[model samples]
Target: MTNMTFSEQIWYGLFKPSKYKELVESRKSRSVLYILVILLVLGLVTFVVPTAAIITGFGGMNKLFSETMAPVAYDGNQLTIEEPFRMNVADTVFILDSTYYTVPDKELERDGTYIAVGSKNVRMTTIIGGEKWMDNITPIEQVLAPGFSNDSLVDMVPAIYVSLFLCYLIMCLLYFVKYGFLALILSFIINSMNKQMEIGLSFGQVYMVCFYGMSLGMLLTNFNIAMGLISPMLVSTVTVFVSMNFITMAMVSMRKGNQV
Candidate 1:
């Protein structure tokens, strides 16, 4: 059995696929479990820096709402604002104009105004992967809670943060499921390949190989998310490519009886 620590194993896993033969031969399923747990923890920790940046940036949001936003009132029937509010960020626009109940499709497409609030109702457009979604309209009464007012806007920031934290947890759970499923599929493929080559790898051993091979991909995915550097689809595509490449290299090394 190899005397490598978990951290050393991870390093070798990324930079030295030939080392996988020795790692697999070690038969330390407990080490594999430790690696999986460490990966999950690292995934969650990746959000901390970005979350801190967002929290620090809330000062600007507070200023925007407190200073730029006019006092607004939403009665049971109609919504009223003293003045229109507009802000544009990159490809997205936010608008609060009480005159028009609905925005024209042509204008929305041209201006990329995904959110528009008016007197009677609020119209929202969602776009994903360059596809424009249908507009969702909600009556003003339904949009605003009974006690919602301009004065309470700042107070709601904490609740929004709480909701975001909850969303992060949900995302982590989904990622865990996705990672496990992908590893299982890869293990199956590797095991079948090994059978044809007479390498005689068990499912458990192949699974451990997949777990280690996918580490770099998981790190890249989390880094992309924290940086917001690419689209979600692009991130997923890159992750799969990187992971498969590493797995292939590791399996090849195993077949050749390579070691660190």
Candidate 2:
């Protein structure tokens, strides 16, 4: 195990759970920390392309607004635009028509539906469960804060990036908590069963085994998320199942003295 390169360690961690016994016995305690850091870094890497696309999308929207949007003003009561504006991006339609007080029924039936800015309020319509759902009408004055203008949209780009970073941090924290909880549970189970064999593994050692065993599951979870292939709950369930299976195999190998 000491002779194994990092890539070989990862390969064994994913494909050969029996090798985890050697990892648990021969590796330093910090090996678990190293695995955790690697997993977290992989998680962060999965978000890079999506985050970049979001920022670029915002930039494009700002450019579109700057170039095409007419000068608009809002008083305490009504919103006034120099001309009625309408734009459709993909399936969603944005309309700034002061004459219409509500989103038209036809617009609400489409996939992405409509967000209509009327003189007094903004109305949004969404389709859920094959039914049209109208969002609460927001007053124009409430929607447009005082001193807020279209120019402020560009200023929000930095804040958007900051928000994305915070979200990524929060996600990493959740992953850490989730993985730790799984490791603790597996360690307890392994220790309880080990009483029969008298293998005498400590909680920390079992935890290290479990963490190392989780390599493949974590990678698959990240891949599924990046590809948007499954629901979050399904992905989580599969990860838990895979990690537990790998950890069980590792514990069995440890008991058999196969790879120690």
- Residues 1-260 of candidate 2 have per-residue lDDT tens digits of 46777666766767788887666666674476566665577556566555556436646656745655776666666776778887654334678876665545654555555778887888877665567665667877777765544676567756755765775666677677877787778777777766667777777777777777776777777777666788967987988888878877777777787852
Candidate 1 lDDT over 108-168, as tens digits, reads 6553327788888788876655567657888877778765667676777678568656645
TM-score, prediction 2: 0.61
Local accuracy by lDDT, each model: 0.69, 0.69
- Mark the regions of model 2 whose C-alpha exceeds 4 Å error after superposition: 1-5, 26-29, 38-42, 56-145, 230-241
Question: Residue 127 lDDT in model 2?
Answer: 65
Which pairs of residues have clashing backbones in candidate 1?
Answer: none
